[model samples]
Target: MRRAAASVTIVTILLLLTGCWDRLPLRDLQMIDVIGIDQDEKEQGVTVDLIVTSLKGAGKGQGEPIAERTTLKGPSVIEAVGKTEYMDQGPFLAVNTRAFLMSESFASDKPVEEFKFLLHAPYTSINTPVIVYAGKMVELVNNKSSNRQAPIEKLHNFIKSLNSNGVINNISMHEFISSADEPLEDYPLPVVRYHESKFQIEGAMLFHSGRYAGKQITNEQLRMLMFMLGVDQGRQRITGSVSDSKSGLQDITYGFSVKNVRRSVHTQKGTDRLPMVTIRVRLNINVFDIGDNIDTLKPNYAVVMEKLLGKQFEQEAAGMIRTAQQANCDVLGIGKHIKAFHPKLWKSLDWRKDYPNITIAPKFDIQILNTDGFEQFQ
Candidate 1:
């Protein structure tokens, strides 16, 4: 009787543990690797493209191309996602999705509040990479990778490379939301595009108060901004004409593989009227290249290089500021500086109205920390 009672208790426990009746087998569950969001041209709705990876021995390669893509449309993001089943599967699982690609049209449509809500879904992963493309999401996904890597992994690697190079800020869902709510700073999203059968970071999208404000900054402008923001790393090459005493309009190129970038912004109250913003940037550069042989390099090559770099930096800074001001956008975080130093004054002034009138004086101080292989010029 005791043995039977123990057996009965074990059977009851096993039955209780088997309550996960809704659990699908691994073979039955469809693992989604990528989700693409775009705007519907015909209807005022959102279209979702899902790239699903099947586990059924499709091939021997890992992340093999057994992936299937389907498009669904609906009035809202949730509805659009829910309607994804109409394309192929009766019902699909997306908890294993690796990335989300949002089309520029869909991203710039409105407040992006609905998208934010979709991000909070139980199946959505916070760490999943998000990319912004300009064309149809499906087309972007269909673009082939040159390296023979999976499309999703290729996109992930491209974004990661851009972030590591400090070419653009990482614009994840969390970062976007945080910047949108910030009263002093504008949110910048890294833009991706398919070119020449490969993915690239075109530039960054600047937003003011949750809306697309204007055109993106150029690649050079993005580099300069990265330097100003103290995030510049890797190599930056600047080539221009140096008016030599003898060689009239000589082509001189200077390559700086940056070691560090230190910057500071100071606002001064002038008696004349509007406050003046003074920006000082100190750069530690590794001199990697020069135009000609090091033996023929000028004695004042370092000084000339510094001057040329300074001019270039100044021009870039001025262009960035002018473009932002022209677009009625403040992306340089000038408001944050004011709030930090002059809280009372900032409170009294309306940044939106006063941004157009703000004056900025940028100063650059670049020093060559190491000459590396090009030390002959020194």
Candidate 2:
């Protein structure tokens, strides 16, 4: 009797100790890798596209499943997501989402309103990058990778590269929400497009008062913008033509890597109603390429190149500031600076009305450390 009772107790304990009793089987879970949000054409509903990978059972000899897209529509985000259950695949899980792609129209419609659902959704990853796509959400999510890598993986890696190069901010959903919550602050999101059979982060979407300003920053303007913000990642390369004093030599095109950057912003009471703001940036660079060598060993070579590069950036800064003012975007956070140091001035004026009228001066200082890479020998 005693042996039988001990055996029964052991059996009961073993049964209770078994793990994963409530866990969903892997084969039944459809993991979402990317979410694309877009507005319906009728303007009364939302469209949610889930790029997912479904798992298969053992011994099926099934290779890795290709990512498939499921489009669902409803009046709101929650309802749209809920509709995923009626599909043949298992329930949708968002914890594995790698990125969120928002259509230009959807992002322009009202960024905060459309993003609120993702902010509050349970089990969703908030740190995933939020990108603004130029084309249709369905086509972009379904597009195949050019190099045979997974489309979503390729995009994620590309974004990482751009972020490291200081080309884009790579803003996340959480960061966007935080910036939107703050006063006199705005955010820029990296913009991607399908070009030449591949996805590229070609520009950025600027926001003002939590709405798209209908402006995009690209190429040199984008680089200058990042430089002014003091966010240059030190790996950015710049190329421009500099006047060559050598006789009969055309202007030399030069390329250099940004080795270091020092930036400062100053705002003080001015003779006018709005405060005067000055943005100063100093760039330390290493010259790696010169279209034609004209005695780089000469003592004046570095000095002349530095002055020319400085002038070149000064002009670019003016254009960057113009674009920001036209969009009324305070990318530099000058208003935040005033609010922090000069509370009285910040409280007395409507920043939105005064921002466009204020004068912002950007000054650049360039230092060329070397020219050995392109040095000419007799």
Q: Best candidate per TM-score, number?
A: 2
**Reference-based lDDT, residue 163, model 2:** 80
Candidate 1 local lDDT, 1-378, one digit each (tens):
999999999999999988776766555567676778888888988888877776654334533345666667888777877664564554435534676778888777763565566455554555655567867787765763432355666777877777777777676655554555665557566778876667777777777766677667776777777777777654444444444444343566656466678989988876655688878899877565656454344546666667767876888888877777776677777888788889877877778888878888778898865433355222
Lowest summed lDDT across 10 adjacent residues in model 2 is found at 369-378
TM-score of 1: 0.80
C-alpha lDDT of candidate 1 relative to the true structure: 0.69
lDDT tens digits, residue span 213-295, model 2:
77877767778888888876837877777664653336778887888888999888789778889899988877766554634
For each predicted model, how many residue pairs clash, with residues at least 3 apart or on different chains?
Answer: 0, 0
The TM-score measured for candidate 2 stands at 0.83
Those runs of model 2 whose alpha carbons end farther than 4 Å from true positions after fitting are 1-29, 42-44, 55-66, 88-96, 145-148, 242-251, 294-297, 371-378
Candidate 2 residue 128 C-alpha distance from true site, Å: 0.5
**Please, what is the TM-score per model?**
0.80, 0.83
lDDT of 2: 0.75
Q: What is the C-alpha lDDT of each candidate?
A: 0.69, 0.75
